[model samples]
Target: MNANHMNDIRKYLKYSILNNCNFVGHERERNQIFDLIQRTIRCGESNSALLIGPRGSGKTTLVNDVLTGFHKNKSFVSDAILVKLHGLIHTDDRLALKSATSQMNLDNAVDGKVFGSFAENLAFLLACLRTGEKHTSKSVVIILEEFDLFCAHHNQTLLYNLFDISQSAQAPICILGITCRLDVIELLEKRVKSRFSHRQFFLFPCEEDSKESPLDHTIKRIECYLSLPENSRLKINGAVRKQWNTILKALLEDKKFRSTIQRLVDVDLNERTLRNILVCFFDQL
Candidate 1:
């Protein structure tokens, strides 16, 4: 293939692999989080969970996939109020509360009104959600991205209040925190810990099978990512895809290539690492 063709493949591969959410791993975590949020939204039972994993473990993808599924449901679309707070953007409790209020569309209520302290304003917002009829209130789903940063806030009031809300059966609130920090659980105070559901999920890269010399689902993921449809942008025929598959087959069958992959597995051949390898391969092509 020429450099232009290779570049096209690389660009498409990156987006295809990235936009592909039908990953082979994390089935258990996906189901658990899905059901947790469903119960909170449907049954009006509050829930909280923390997703702890290093980068490229598909932590964000898993939540997004599950939430996307919920988004398809008519009731979920109508009843759910999603408030996403990022630690990088909202540096402290005050800013976090302000953003939350805005995301929840409460700005109009306080429009042209005096802005109260963070605690008072936050409590007022929570009270508004709580005032709805039991089992008929809008379900509030709060997702804290880079949750570890939220933990470092002074006094941890945001975490405390959110956790407190999730402990109640009347409030249909679900709090999902995504963080790479392993010690995030330790950051919570003793009082905040009591309200938390203590439901935590850990994610890691998939491992190779014990019997086969295969790379588990890694190769499958690559194939799924690179295969172009008949009407694909590249306008390449099935011949290119077949040739690519043949190349993959030869590499897997080659003893030296298998050894090289096994060595890469030592440092961890996660999705990100595999993508980097493909970039180099495309450059050489």
Candidate 2:
């Protein structure tokens, strides 16, 4: 290909992979989460939230977007410290809390402290919070991914400590748990469950509007990406655009193609997956 053609291809790939994909179509859930975070920041009181959704259903993406907004705001960025933990990485309760304490960069308080015991680790976390209040007046926003894995721990000390600390700590501390399993809450211990108070947000798959089918919605999203302005660097050639239309037509008339789309939608492959599938097909074209 010529130099200009190569540049256009590069631009197209960038737009397809990064620029176009965002946390889309979760307006209600996004608003509730944003409000909770704002409330915690304003009141200087800790808040714990549970976000439940299936895999690839945009729970993590939504939370990341909210965090990005907070970071962008000058007034909130200074007072909020974002910390993320993967539950699968830290299976043990003590280890998870210790890891959080370490993230706070309170080495002076955490050093030489034996985090092997749950109480010691919990103490370290509290100390870190106290230090945060005294020094930076910052609130720690902890995002726990794979929350179901964390709930599998036997003792449930980690959940207790987190809820207790959030309630008692002077500086606000928010624990946002993201899990795929719907019944994960049933796994929490009784005391922890009561303490948590079931502050949960459920993210359902995006549904088709009254005027359109799921397939139609998917087609519309694909069309939006393909319809990027001519002035844009990302160029979609005639052949690729023709291929996309062919695929859509197949989806409408061909039994096998229709079944494939239906299966993916039934499994909760919403607009996000639609974009990914189209991008993959476009790359081949």
lDDT of 1 by residue, 1-285 (tens): 566665666777767665666555667778898998999788878899999989877788788888888888999977878889999999998788888889888887766756455546665676566545553678889999999999889989899888876775445889999999998889898998888888999876663423323364665666666665566576555777567657767766688866777787777777776767876775575
Return the top candidate by TM-score. 1
Report the lDDT of model 2 for residue 146. Answer: 96
- True lDDT of residue 57, candidate 1: 77
Which residue window of length 10 is worst by lDDT in model 2? 128-137
* Deviation in Å, model 1, residue 249 alpha carbon: 5.8
* Candidate 2 residue lDDT tens string, 77-101: 6667677889888987667766776
Q: Pick the lDDT winner.
A: 1
- Model 1, runs deviating above 4 Å: 1-11, 115-119, 126-135, 207-214, 229-257, 283-285
* lDDT of model 2 at position 132: 29
